[model samples]
Target: MKTIPTLSLALIGALSLSACQDKTAAPEDIRPVRYAVAGGNAETGGARYAGEIRARNETQLAFRVGGKVVAKLVNSGEHVKKGQPLARLDPSDYQLDLAAKQAQLAAAQSDLAQQQLNLKRYHELLAKQFISQAQVDAQQNGVNAAQAKANQARAVLDASRNQTGYATLTADADGVVSQMQAEPGLVVAAGQPVARLSQDGAREVAIQVPENALEAVRAASSLRVTLWKGGAPLPGKLRELAADADPATRTYPARIALPGDSHGLQLGMTADVALPAQASRQLSLPLTAILDLQGKHYVWVVDDKTLRVSRKAVEVGAIDSDNAAIASGVRAGDKIVTAGVHLLHEQQRVKLLGQ
Candidate 1:
């Protein structure tokens, strides 16, 4: 065989090196990934939340002024009518105050009478030219001043009488006492709640709904309330829903108005609220598909055509052990990585495990 030229050998070596690099570069490393299709969540019968029976209007009865409680007229659970006295504070100080105000009024009235006589005498003297116009004018002004002082004293006396009346705590409306915080010999401050009065009117069931279930509660078609003592469910309607969630419980307070004659549903009684399942057209995913970072949650979504995955932020609600209901983010029919999500990365090539 004839030996190849050195230049030809160099050319063949370069071609082989180029072929090896091309082969390595053309074959990409593809990862196998498992995914599941997201769709609308299933509807259960209803979501049950614990709640309590309450009155439509429950008022806290507090004293308008601070004083030592002298007597408690009503016991807990006692029925009271409008303007009925429930408790009494020591009225000795208030009595003294009223007496002093009356005394001041009397003194003012006496001074006004004397000033009126002086003014009349000055006017007569002016008519006869016995006094100058300036003297008469000054006496008239003094009389006006005395009359103003008398009016002020009368107003103060009326206010003092009102204060004395405040010493007796009376019910503003017909209601039943639910609680009593202060008793005889106990000193209470102004605006301190002495009792809780449940007004005799419409009744309701108070329920605390979690943040995730708040919308469901609001969208509920109907509600059923069952007493904890094992009675038939009573039909209830949504009366009020809190605009904000409680900071500590992260739950919204909702009130369901019960029938006026909801038998056996008394105030402060425990009850169970049942909200029927709501139909939703939003997609849901397994909790394992989501990754929580910082304070937000995200998911790995797959591209159907490209077989690649990208990180997507998602808004989740009402998470259970296996799945989480999606409020926003991924839509219906979107494929999400269900397993080995943490091992995946953004914009990474992937191949379906069963494909």
Candidate 2:
């Protein structure tokens, strides 16, 4: 009777332990992943860059000769017609030089006339046998030498006149004065910029693009310019891009040429240049979402209904802001695992954390 009771207690304890193990087992561990929808951030519409209005042609106005500045006829922001005087140098010195050149020219002409008269008289003397043929030839040579001196003096006088004209700086074309480098009483060298002229023509938008965004800017399919003063955007095209980046900011300088006859466009106005995003299927995601394995790029895409993650290969394109553009192999509205991509496996069931 004691053995039977002891065996029965052991059997009941074993059954109880089995029942507890079946009732209270550890739960299955599922990984929670951070994910983001494609086509978000800077990829939705376009990428914008801060820009400024500018003229297509900016010319540095300078004098052809060095002189002391006597007057500045036009101030910065003033518009002038072609050949309009912008500044003037002291013409007194140039006038004096012109007078001296005139005097020299008169003296040369007098000498030339005297030589011609002497040559004519020598010819008559030689005909009468009063002078040798060699003497007449020598007088002819002296006349030729005097003629050359007169020609040289005439050229010098013409040059002096041109220099006098150069003393007055004038605009070569119709333009607005953008900057003034010379002031009254300032002596400037020849070819030194006296003022900057912004010629009236096609306008352009200038912007600085960061190093990483250069490719996106270059590959932009379409571009538009929006003024900061609130107006409709104007169509634009890429006109210039710097080959190397700036040393201080590490940015590439770019210029977008606008159409001719840009009304309401003013110089130095702030603007925004828009580089439209790629076509409808283009998607962009964070760098963490892209996995590089075996020299290829991949992203973990989650199925909305099942919440199961699968590795999918994607083609990457130019960088747009902080996101990498997906050229192909991805579509809009797909949920991509944005963090801890390395730990994911194919067909892994995942739970998303609140974004």
Candidate 3:
């Protein structure tokens, strides 16, 4: 056998190295993706959230001024009429202040009366040429000054009288007392919640909705509220939806307005609020599956046999924070890439991450 040249051996070695690299080339990456079957969410009939019955006009009742509470006249759950006295503070000091203001006002009025008499006498003296015109003007100025002081004292007396009334707490509207926080001896600051007053008015159901369901709940035309006390579901309308989410719960607080009768719904009663579902048989997908490109909505449809992903434009109807209803462009049985859709392209091989 003839020995090969050194350059040819080197050339053969390079070819062998290239072949090995080709054999070890990274397998075409088949990205693993999380997916969901269309219309697979079990709560499709309606989304029910646990909630509580609440007053549409609940308010915190507190005193305008700080004082020792002398009495709490009502208990929780007691119905009260407008202008009814609910509680009272010690009014001894307030009354004393009012009396002092009265005394000040009385003294000021007496001084003003004396000043007016002096001005009258001075004007008569000027008319008889017994006093200079300048003296009459001076006396008139004194009367004006005294009158101003009397008016100020009168205003102060009125404020002092009002303060005495502040010692007693009265209901601003007809309502039920849902809670009482002050007792006979409790000293509270001004504006401290002494009681919770649920004004008699329209009733409501208070519920917390997850971020994903916020929009759907807000857009709901009407809902059914079932109290834990076991009665027929009450009809309600979406009244208020919080714009921001709660920090601790990460959920939005929503209130559904019920009629004034609402079958005598009691405040703080546990309840269930059910949002109306979408149209019959309409498929919905997790909001994550939606892909919006150039103002058009799309979704990644996965082929079962080939495990390949194909981007398809979809008709997106109502969309909540959690899911979007599909009007067209996909079927009920089609598998959809729920997550990692933005990272995918047309006709890409994929692996299902167990549903």
Candidate 4:
């Protein structure tokens, strides 16, 4: 009787232990996942683009006359004032040309004086009946020819002097020499670029946009420009955009004009521009939260009360690298599974993490 009672107790205990194990194992099938509340308001569409700081006005300075670059007065990156001499040409040739012109003018003036004296003598002779009218007329014509030659030589001399002045390259505006193309001993022609001047004040940024995004970029409501070195964001406005795409880059070039005091900005400094997209306000979610099935997009949204997930169809708009712009079907404040979404099903029981 004692053995029978002990055996019965052991069997009952085993049955009770199995029952407890079954109770604990039943809930293990419910998977735990990380969930985030989709409670953010529709974000303003925006994108970032890389660009470089530039001057609002850039000028290429060159010499007006052709000559050997005998002297480079300013180095690259040197600041210059308006009318400052930037470079000089070999003035030896110009001086010689000027001397020749002056000599021609002087000779012509002397000839004119001689012709006037001859004309006076011929008139006297003609008055005395010593010379023919044709002879006096020839003297008058000689005087006129000498006078015209003198005037022509004088004009040529003036042009030669101007050319001499042009031998010295001067800055047309107050700016910094951003580049130098000619050095000492290099002969450059007239209108050949010798230096690049970046005009002072009113800086801008040069950026390029792809064909697909060019229109949106141009239509941005506002722009914020930030330097790569990091500083307070600077306000910028679109000054102009390229009419056609660049052949090599196939991108439209753009310029953003910066206003106010941009103290720390410098030429050629890399920058980033933020432009708001003109598209309508839309909700954006992580790309991983989206699931594709049979060509349709779906997302796992959880009920706030039951913690059960349901598959909801979503109208996807723009798909960026990391996020998808949801156009419809998913409302704000809905709990969505960002990770491990593919493993979930409709009405599937799930344990919420970070509750």
Candidate 5:
């Protein structure tokens, strides 16, 4: 019984020693801390918009007469000058018709010549009393009839020639061939588009603006367009605003004319546009500072006194080439985590790198 009491005393002494060791352990060993620096506000200028580049004029090249295509001289993306032959239909039928009309014209001319001679002879005979007045009148009528037939034949010849010319499709303007819908041996109808041509001229950036954003866009006086390829921003003027919104997207179409030569620009190229909202001093930050969880967007901000992280929900406005505009949720003098936000949580302690 005395041995059991001694063993119990020993166990109690060991438990007290373990409690003292736990109190002496370093706090850093229990929870590790990381340092994060706050991001400084960046100056933002305007709202950046994205849109597609388009040519000022586009046309469809098609044959004027229906026939089987004999040859397609041009392909898509081929640059063609005005009057260049784009395609040709079979002209054999048209050529035969023209030949037939020519032959008829020749016969009509011979008949007209014969009628003229007869009418002259009749006039001379009537002058000498060799023919009666009725005979001369009949001869004159015959001459008029022959002349009318000659005129009809001439018209038919001209029409046949025109039809022959119509077999060849030509470009109406200098442009790049954007599409080719027909090939050799394909039978195409008159006025059916065989190719699409995009005329070279002033280029515009076409953008679809949400209906709710139209008021703000109209209120702005000017906007700047930045080519994705990088250079000086081209000054833009609002040329047109659609009267109605698109039924499918519920957005209004807006077009901006870009000043300067658009020689290098091509259709479907993407461009970035910047529109200035009300000019006011606001806090802007790099896009890296923004974070997303589920569908909500937030930013990690540093507490001035505790040096701990605070998650703040922010309303983001527009994004430009480098930064994003913060409409709400952040203010000046607040230090925002610029990097390593993925490793942070609410109320997490952090040590400043420099401090």
Candidate 6:
């Protein structure tokens, strides 16, 4: 019985030693890290900018002659074709002036015929020496004077006819009548604007960019334009940059050309333009890897030897789709925390979840 008890005690001690050894040898539990993965790739920066849709060509239609507007053939928002009649002035005054000129021209023609006959008679008499040379010379002078008067009268007649034609206003090109400045019975001055015509053709988007961003705008390759109705994004090429900044707002204007048929687009419609930001080869990482604290952006980077994490400040450039482009602070080859960045703090020790 004594030997059995001693053997039992020895067995219990060995088991207790084994249990302690097992406890010491066991591996520590590693917390699983949840992360989102993003690949570094070429991406375009998207920015929403307000813009205006404008016609490629717009012209002011005016009258050539001043008169009472007798009739207005077109109204605002009306489409007009080339050579279409837009408005007409009172033709009564112009018609009377033309008729009077015609009458004067007829009288001048009759006088010219009579003068030619008198000149013929005078030359015949001078050759025969039947009449005095002084008398023949006087008749020739009268004939010359009559001919000059006839010519002047004919010129006057033609001018009156031309004035008559100027009473009507016509469109010089195909366009839509955007504005009407004249109404019936309205007396307008010569060369006064009668209507505003917008030519049917290409469309452009005008955007105002900050003066400080002018340098980046000049370096950008292209811009993105979006239509308001469908929110459709279309590629637009940079066409022109304003020479001077706006005095009131301190912004530079930029014009971009939108491709495709512009017939459906109305003048003065609003557009959204995305201007390219400064080009930079940034360290792009997943959005989940970025942590926002105290209104500042930061990220977690891993230490290679110790497998620890440290928070670092980053200047973000553009959010390309889902990835954040890091302008500064992080390098290309740095091991960034793909997941579990929210759970990390400055100089926090960490173990690779999988490794």
Instruction: Give the top-scoring candidate (TM-score).
Output: 4
User: For model 2, which pairs clash?
Assistant: none
Give residue 151's lDDT in candidate 5 (0 to 100). Answer: 100
> lDDT of each prediction vs. the true structure?
0.86, 0.89, 0.88, 0.86, 0.82, 0.80
**If the candidates were sorted by their lDDT against the true structure, best first, what order would they fall in?**
2, 3, 4, 1, 5, 6
Q: What TM-score do all the candidates reach, one by one?
A: 0.67, 0.70, 0.68, 0.76, 0.70, 0.62
- Report the C-alpha lDDT of model 1 over 16-134, residue by residue, as the tens digit: 99999998889666788778787735642467878888889999999898999989999999989999999999999999999999999999999999999998898888999999999
Worst 10 residues of 1 by lDDT: 38-47
- Give the candidates in order of TM-score, highest first: 4, 5, 2, 3, 1, 6
> Which scores better on lDDT, 2 or 3?
2
Q: Tell me the tens digit of each residue's lDDT in model 3 across 80-101.
A: 9998999999999999999999
lDDT of 6 at 212: 65
Task: Give RMSD to native, each candidate.
Answer: 11.9, 6.7, 10.6, 6.2, 5.0, 11.0
- Superposed by TM-score, candidate 5 places the C-alpha of residue 28 at a distance from the truth, in angstroms, of 5.0
lDDT of 5 by residue, 1-355 (tens): 3466888999999999999999887474112333233224345666667998877777977888999998989999899999999999999999999999999999999999999999999999999999899999999999999999999999999999999999998899998888987799999888998899888888889998887678777776778888887777788878888999999989888988888898778887889877874454556777777898888779988877987888999988766666677888977767777667787878887776531
Model 4: per-residue Cα lDDT over 198-297, one tens digit each:
9988899999988887777767767989899988888888889999999999989999999876567788999999886444566778888889999999
Candidate 6 clash pair list = 35-339
The lDDT of model 2 is: 0.89
The count of residue-pair clashes in candidate 2 stands at: 0
Candidate 2 per-residue lDDT over residues 251-316, each given as its tens digit: 898999998696789899999998885454567788889999999999999999999999999999
List pairs with backbone clashes in candidate 5: none
Off by over 4 Å in 1: 1-43, 278-355
Residue-level lDDT for 284 in candidate 3: 79
